[model samples]
Target: MSKSQVEVNRFKVKAQLMQLESDPIAVEEPLQISLVQNNKSEIFSLTMRTPGHDKELVYGLLFSEGIIENSDDVERLESQLHEGERQINQQEVILAEDISIEWSRFGRSYASYSGCGLCGKTSLQALELKQSRALKPIKSKIDNGLIRRLKALLAEQPLFSQTGGVHAAGLVYEKQGELILSKTPFFEDVGRHNALDKLIGHELLANDLNQAGLLLLSGRIGFELVQKAIMAGYSTIVALGAPSNLAIQAANQFNVALIGFAKDQSFNLYTADKNKVVCREPLD
Candidate 1:
């Protein structure tokens, strides 16, 4: 729908009879990201992701990796089109003059795949070395009924509905005493982390991360996803898939509520403060 889906011809076999049909597939392409400072540029990361929202991907990845503190650290984003083509496969992020970078933290020795978020880290110790702010306690209660609706909302994502091959990340917030899913802030990508990065990037650029909200993931919850959510200061996360053991531990460590296996009728809350998440009956 957004240049992220490409139609492909495939064979459909039905009881020994084969027929050719065309279907949409999520586009996967390499993005070479570089960081620029003081007129010098250096390659930051190479990741396979969907082609659209490249700028947001860069912003989100940098923010997640602790390369940049806030949107102010980014001066501007520049895209490099493939020679004579309109497709953007590379991005250059110009950083403020005063910003400092620690190259050792990246440890990227290989191209990162769309399904893997912890590709380059040498070990768990490396991740722990990066300082994350202490997550503040959630002051308001979250309704379980609202959490159950997250998956339904994500089901409406155009990219996933078209290809069924991409993961989605969305932000839900309270407004006018009612919970509302953000319409413009949702993102979809072949990689779950990239989708979340895009959402975080947009919020970072808009300086709206302080708003208390719940992060929704269309797939399984992993350690990196929890790490990213914590880095972004989100106190609650709901996913349609199961969570990894590390994710559960991290959520407990940070005092963040990690909800997984979210369905239309039921969901699992892995970790949360007592009296924080309330169970409510479905409305008729």
Candidate 2:
């Protein structure tokens, strides 16, 4: 399980009154992901994340960034602790013999913060071509009512409920324009991309990315999130927050259905070919 929150003492102040309380702050830590191939291993990325589901995070990240196509591309994943630390703070991914990787393209020598996704890219052209998978035809449609219900389901995340500082991503399926939550587990991280990566990793490990026709994000939809969704083959992405202009452009180019501001039983479709989303009864 991911360590979602940590207890800290704080002083709460009200007009002329102060109370000491133990607050549950969201946990954030540095996670070093390393890639291992041909008996040689190198640090891949350093990210800030909540401790848990680390292996899934690594697998999802590698797959999303075009490092490996599928679960079969990597033989196994391992973790290494810092000096005497008991917890596995560093992770290593070993590629299968049949797989070939160009580690130079990964920019493994650089470290990026959780807030930015393109920090390591050498050029804008490289970022544009990051996703190796060609866009697949989007055939899935989601009803407004089902999307609202799915959003409500996503709100049940225990980590965010306790800390209110984490982001979440869920894999959802569309059935007859209705929503179906895949068995793939949900992921919560301090970083939005990390959460998405964890969710992607879960689906990859389960070998059911196709079943996840829709993606629900707890935060705003941005270029990075859009790219990850496209890489993972999601036809639709619903976000609780607004969508960035670049995200809209990417979705339009890829023919993905992008919905934003999904709240109060209504959502704004940023880009959906043929206006596929069908609204439902007004929220009571």
Candidate 3:
């Protein structure tokens, strides 16, 4: 488990303007997840992910992809960071052989997720999730003022704020018009999907999965992201940018409320019900 760590940053020049001793942060690291089973071999995603939470990342990946259904289905998840050298322990996952994963298709590279990318897939014969009918009403409503403030807060968390090179996601809660964040945590990755996978890992570890709030992304909403929202049980998903067609499609299918282009005094609600703030015209 010692090798199960990675060096995310290295000493490099700042803006190529000055070579520093401390090293700029390395936000991404390679993680090779080993899949083991009888007959078929374990294929890896070769995901270029952020350091830490590698175990949860693998669990989320497998669960979200329909590879495994519940915790009982999973035997155990473990890692070894490239044999040694203080890098992410790059994990070797052991799952029941009834589950098969084909890594060749993953292309030994980073894979981004669209919460619903599987909606159109035709050949993934695997165990389906045992989730019940979504209990919340289709619509989700939030105070107009909180929506505005959350938008502002979502724009602030990235560690790469100075570099503008990372994507971020956070679980946010609203109580009495005040926005409260989960002690869980947030993540910033070179890829938006990766950032979310990290966030999911954090949420799972903290066991703060009430699923009573919204997921705020600093990027656009996509099918893969929508899938995460569903798996995470988040009722509302808000993005600071436009949403993709597939993302909207999945949101509708899963009954999760979706909001996009959330900035300033504007936002659009997609496929959700319950809480909303309709703006009334100001009196002259």
Candidate 4:
């Protein structure tokens, strides 16, 4: 079994009988993250996440939190593994010597659960102040058909198919008039935010965030998820579920094309810069 899930024996209760069966449960574990700079290390976050692609998770977290502008700002990442075990519960991020961090903006350290995305923020005002400039408008328009196709791809998620408890995030990039889902840019996690972070982190490391891509989420779009997408320079976002009010507002503020409730035939476009995303006309 993959480390992302664990096999458990549980009682399956039905209308008439109870049977014991082996099921796959998504694994959730605490990962303590520390930032190292100037020979000083400080633990800033403790997040519950699935046990895999930890390096991408850290990169995504740092990027979303505005700790690092790019992958170059992070010198190296060191995993603290338990003795005699391959499981890692801690990670140390070494920043480049020239990098400077504004701790005041970071607010306080807190534990982030798998279900909550904005757990440690001090206030909405502070979060608003940290918003970066609006993303550059994309030259290509996303086809509604392509947006609908994303839902069908969910069956490809390995972890979600097994546990049905994890969220997934994927990036579909526009290349030479074709929308292609990059092989390595999709990630699944117990947390929606962590899934997006892993996807963004992988692109950040590859220096591919500049590509015109659509961010796809298997779950609802919250304000935090939209904020992360903006920070990562995504201009278009499509989700399989609904979007929160705050999420719509943030997307508008950043001029992001946010689409939600992506079904097999229809989806809601909450906010869009017409120049960036153009939808096809309705059929008679």
Question: Mind giving the per-residue lDDT tens digits that candidate 2 earns over 1-284?
Answer: 23655554433322223345654444544567777888988667776555688878888888888888888998887877766544677778888877777767754454443465535532113435255465444445445556667777777899999999999998765556444565436799998989999998888888776664668899877667888888888878878876655566678788778877677445666565534654345342
lDDT ranking from best candidate downward: 4, 1, 2, 3
Which residue runs of candidate 3 sit more than 4 Å off their true CA positions? 1-140, 174-178, 181-184, 280-284
lDDT tens per residue, model 4, 137-254: 4555555555555776776788888999999999877777566754426899998998998998898899887777778899987667887998888888888876655566677887
What are the models' TM-scores? 0.57, 0.56, 0.51, 0.55
RMSD of each: 15.9, 15.7, 16.7, 16.1
Clashing residue pairs for model 1: none
lDDT of 1 by residue, 1-284 (tens): 56776654433322223345654545555677778999998877767576787878888888888888889999999888755445787788999999998776655533464668446532213445232555544455555456555666888899999999999998876555555665536899998989999998988898887766778899987667888999888888878886655567677887788766666655655676535555555453
Work out how many backbone clashes candidate 3 has.
30
lDDT scores in order? 0.71, 0.68, 0.58, 0.72
Candidate 1 stretches with Cα past 4 Å from truth are 1-114, 129-140, 175-178, 182-184
Q: The CA-based lDDT of model 4 is what?
A: 0.72
Looking at model 4, how many pairs of residues clash? 0
- Any runs in candidate 4 off by more than 4 Å, and if so which? 1-114, 117-120, 129-136, 182-184, 274-284
